[model samples]
Target: MNMSIVKKLKALHQLALSLTCSALLSLPLVAETAWRIDTVASDLDFAWSLAFMPDGRFLVTERTGQLVILNADGSEAKRQAAALPDMFVAAQGGLLDVLLAADFDSSGRLFLSYSCGNLNANSTCLASAQLINDELTAIRPIFRAQPERRGAAHYGGRMVQLPDETLVLTLGDGFDYREQAQNKANHLGKTVRLTVDGAVPADNPFVNQAGIAGEIFTLGHRNVQGIVYDPQTGQLFSHEHGPKGGDELNLLSAGQNYGWPVATYGVDYTGARVSPYQRFVGMQDPLYVWTPSIAPAGMTLYQGALFPEWQGNIFVSALAGKALHRLQLTAGKVTAEQVLLADLATRLRDVRTGPDGAIYLLTDGAKGQLLRLLPN
Candidate 1:
């Protein structure tokens, strides 16, 4: 590349970053809502995710390494412990995500993403188990990140199972291993797809390629926390926590590289530039970026009949922002943004759309509460 051209590209990148920051920071921080709340459950110990069953019952994962079954109204049905073998409970690691399988009515199997190993050596993992007669049984490990890097943060344990029954999971860059995101030999900073039995899908983007992890579907993520599929449109969306100000909402596609340390909309936490490029060849840009950081956790697509007006909109749970974010979308593009539930004034953890067309939410902390939004 010529020197002059390089300088010009750098200048343009800086300008884009400046404009993005201004547009984001200037938005009004107004909190509004068009729904009423109902407390479904309380005193959950740092609840991370929930799995809803067809029988009006659900399962919730706690950061303390336990899974609890609850009734439709959030009453305790049972608690299942010792399911996550060799679980590592520490900062940003631990029992992370719980999701039910499509054949749950008969197979009784479910999936989980969690942290494994001790503080000195840890890694993100995926496991399967069966719920038989109110107890978790037949728990077995299916997958784990390669190399088992050390560090307690950046586990990135969000997951979604497609209608075809293929499982997708997100893994983080291990905080100290940001550079490995560009290395295909490892699973850092990547989204992976696997079969229900933990086998590598033959059609996976990188399968059969020498020196690459066959499970990886996409690479170059920072620390993804939220991923949801829009069944109506057949589109997948995910959001990741940025270093300082570059939190992003992306339209996910297989084999796409979403630049992280190499090209970011935000800088490092120490006020230094993360990279000099905002747009790079062969790298996909985010559909939406949250400057100043919202610390996104869970996300869901609204196709509910309860709020017909919000059909096809995206709902994201925010931790640092302490609000529920509603992003209006059209043809996979974010058209507008709105903030809801700011009055709650507590860190929000996960958001979901219930079968009844209502919105479900989980708050953060040791005594967190599960909440629901009903049309007023």
Candidate 2:
């Protein structure tokens, strides 16, 4: 063979090999999978909140006051934490949230929030319990609402442990009771800081006050359901339920008043304008406002390897919208927004980033589902 011809033949072979390798590398992209709902793992009962154990098991709370332990693979469920105190379970009451203590491996401690008493006279309660194999032992009510009364619904129950070793609890003002939201004398409509054992943090906003619970860290929230700490800045961001339209996302500040009944960007369900947009002279404005109201429930800021593109974005479960809304953030400001799972249209109750770097969610329903989201 001629030297030039031999050289050309070798080049052609090299080009063909490169093309084949490219095709093989692209195969997985073309064969990507879709998100599937795990109906078998879910139930007719309302699964409200969930947290993962260090061993990968899940401790999930049902709205009816039952705590169940679910295997990692979505099989072999067991009741781990039992004998949850009696709950209101009326409009929005009942077992609200369950969280594993940061030191659960050593302490066997779990914190929870729920409403106690009947529909007409219910109040929010924050309690802690020790999980012993099959039951919750030494169940202790750490903080009870001041001037307890009876009513159903609206308990903001999200727990996040701050860098200060203080637990911040989000609480909702009782249904339609906007006045209580601004009152510092009570725990309603506030985020509180407490010790793991339910003791008041001395640096709390109202610790020096005579009548107020010293646990309050920040006051003036309506129905804050979503609370998360930005690990980057050590700041807490919370999202709350709105009346007809004006849902709010707030960067919670210590000792700051968040205008609720006094100021609002939305109105009442009957179409009456709520408190003026700027009610109090010193009230803080929401970082982001949802005019149509997404009805956000669970919230978490992403920091995982599975989807590096989603880092620093806020994930919120939308109930009325029946979708998961992703808000892009830069320096604590929302720069862009996107909605996921718009086709299924199921009410997304809670969203959390699993230890496996995958996104797991619980749907709201009599037969709600636990779903895992992956990159397509």
Which whole-number lDDT from 0 to 100 does residue 84 have in model 2? Answer: 54
Q: After superposition, how far is residue 357 of candidate 1 from its true place, in Å?
A: 0.9
For model 1, where is the 10-residue window of minimal lDDT? Answer: 1-10
lDDT of 2: 0.75
- What would the per-residue lDDT of candidate 2 be over residues 133-197, giving only the tens digit for each residue? 74678888887666565667678888888765668888887766778888877877888878887
Candidate 1: regions farther than 4 A off: 1-33
Give the residue spans of candidate 2 off by over 4 A: 1-40, 278-280
What is candidate 1's lDDT per residue for 1-376, written digit by digit as tens?
2322213323433443343322233333324447799999999999999778888887889988878888998999898674687789998899999888888889889888899998889999999988888788889999998868887999999999876678889999999999888889999999998999899887787889999999988899989999997666556778999998999987677777889878889889999998998768888778788988999999988988898888888999999999999987654456678988889999999999988899999999999999999989
Q: Count the backbone clashes (under 3 Å) in each candidate.
A: 0, 6
TM-score of each: 0.91, 0.87
lDDT of every model, 2 decimals:
0.84, 0.75
- Candidate 1 clashing pairs? none
RMSD of each: 7.1, 15.0
